[model samples]
Target chain A: MAMTEMRKDDDTALDLFFAEARQSAPEPSAVFLGRILAQAEGVQAGFCATPVQPAVRRGVRAGGLGMLLALLGGWGGIGGMATAAVAGVWIGFAGSDTVAQVAGYAMTTETATASALLADGDILALAAE
Target chain B: MALDALDDVSDETLLVLYGNGDRAAARMLTLRMGPLAFRVAQRMLGDRAEAEDLAQEALLRLWKIAPEWRTGEAKVTTWLYRVVTNLATDRLRRRRGIGLDEAPELPDGAASAVEQMIDGDRAAALEAALAQLPARQRQAVVLRHLEGLSNPEISAAMEIGVEAVESLTARGKRALAAILAGRREELGYGHD
Candidate 1:
């Protein structure tokens, strides 16, 4: 009975001690709050800036490359036309035997032109794909 | 969404908004969780500067992870509590062999003027007694009594069983009582 009474007294004192102790929760310093707020703002800033970048970069690069290829292909077509005109004159000045050879050469050149067209066709195919 | 609208949203929702570049959400979460991080760190570490630094680091980590915060995996405060606890433990390990003779003073913000006038000595005595406790017991008791966390919350924070938390708290209280018994005259509780 005496031991139980002593235990009760101890419990009461402990409760009172803790009750008084708990009255003081330390307030966070202003400097700490400021640092954390600054960091949160920094993160929020990154989230705002990231999403629109990659798509814009891809669009600009692909468009520029396509424009350059079109300009180069147009310049190369002038050279090909001039070569065809020269071949026509040479065939006219030569005989029927030369004509056959010239015709054969023209056929071979046409095949090469056809293959070149096929390569251009591949660019369109790639775009579609 | 309006700040008024955000007041009703959960922490996970706030983090999602924070990831979506919502400044209000970040502000709200900072206002809510920053003090919590500070309070826990201050109590556990018992040093003003170290607690402040730990709290800052914890909040900084929270910001870095906001973009990838899993929606429902864990509560926001729960995750931060674990981080702060681990940081405090790491600091304590680095500070091994130091005695707790110089207990840090608790802030007077939560104490009313009446409390300071009437019970300042008792409060100081209690803090000194708390310093003498083993770290684990001190943490358990502080979380249970001073911080008013539930046994389950203490278990999660301490990563221990609920039974273990209860045992620590009990033994810690007994030890506190015995220590304070020696200074009842100064503590103003006259001995029989």
Candidate 2:
């Protein structure tokens, strides 16, 4: 029992010592506080200087592209788009097999028409035959 | 809130305000957490100058992270303690161990709220004994006794298991007792 009492006393003493020490803790001087506060302001200013603007800019560009795609998709489905692209390619090519084939077809039709007209013009020959 | 009204705000709130560029919040945090970081660094390092530097460095790091400060992630002071712990550990690694005589005891001859409640030499002796403890044991004892941190809080700061914290504290107290028991009479702790 006496030993237990002694232990309790020691505990109390240690507690008292710690409590006292805590109360005596030193604080930062005014100069130190001033310097650190200044540093904080500088840092905050650097951080606040449009830090999120990059993400905002990126979002805006993405939104613009998305709108353009939506409009294009609304105007033409995939098959219609493919047809328009082929027609456009045919019209645009100044020197290509596609252009040569179109020209050749038009010439052949014209030559056939001329031949038929000449045959019709042979009225005497037909009479003789 | 105004600058003068920052006393009522919590550390995390103050950090948020600081993040938002309120100089008042910075002042409030410096006034509040500065002393905590300083005292712990001083106790661990046994050098007031280096302690002040460490405290300032720790708080500066805190300020830098303020913009990313996540509320309820952890208490501001707990984070500060961990910073100080790492800073002091780095410092201790760079220097040889200085004995109890070098331990930063309380300022000589100034009465404080708790100083009046306890005998002064006994407290000084306790600091000396605490200095004699191994670094980890000393940290556990200081956090548990002087700072009055819970074991879980200590575990977080020390980055150890709760059981490990308990064991360290127990061992630290035993070491302190062995070191101080012989001088109980001389230190005026003999009445008990």
Per-candidate DockQ versus the true complex?
A: 0.43, 0.31
Clashing pairs in 2: none
Expressed as tens digits, the lDDT of each residue in B113-174 for candidate 2 is 22333454655666666656666777888889888899999988888899999998977776
Each prediction's TM-score versus the true structure: 0.65, 0.66
| Local distance difference test, each candidate | 0.75, 0.74
Error of 2 at A63 (Å): 11
**Quick one: how many clashes does candidate 2 have?**
0
* Candidate 2 wrong stretches, greater than 4 Å: A1-9, A50-129, B97-120
Q: What are the per-residue Cα lDDT tens digits for candidate 1 across B1-192?
A: 677778888988998898888988988888888998998788777788889889989888888898899887778877887788777766764575553333223213322322333443776767766655666777788788887889998888778899999998988787777776655555666545
Looking at candidate 2, what is the lDDT of residue B61?
Answer: 94
lDDT (Cα, tens digit) per residue for candidate 1, span A1-129? 498787788888778777876777778877778788888999789877745634444323456665664565754766887899998887777767987886899999998786676777786886699
Q: Could you tell me the lDDT of residue A55 within candidate 2?
A: 46
Error of 1 at B64 (Å): 1.8
* Model 2 chain A weakest lDDT span, ten residues long: A53-62
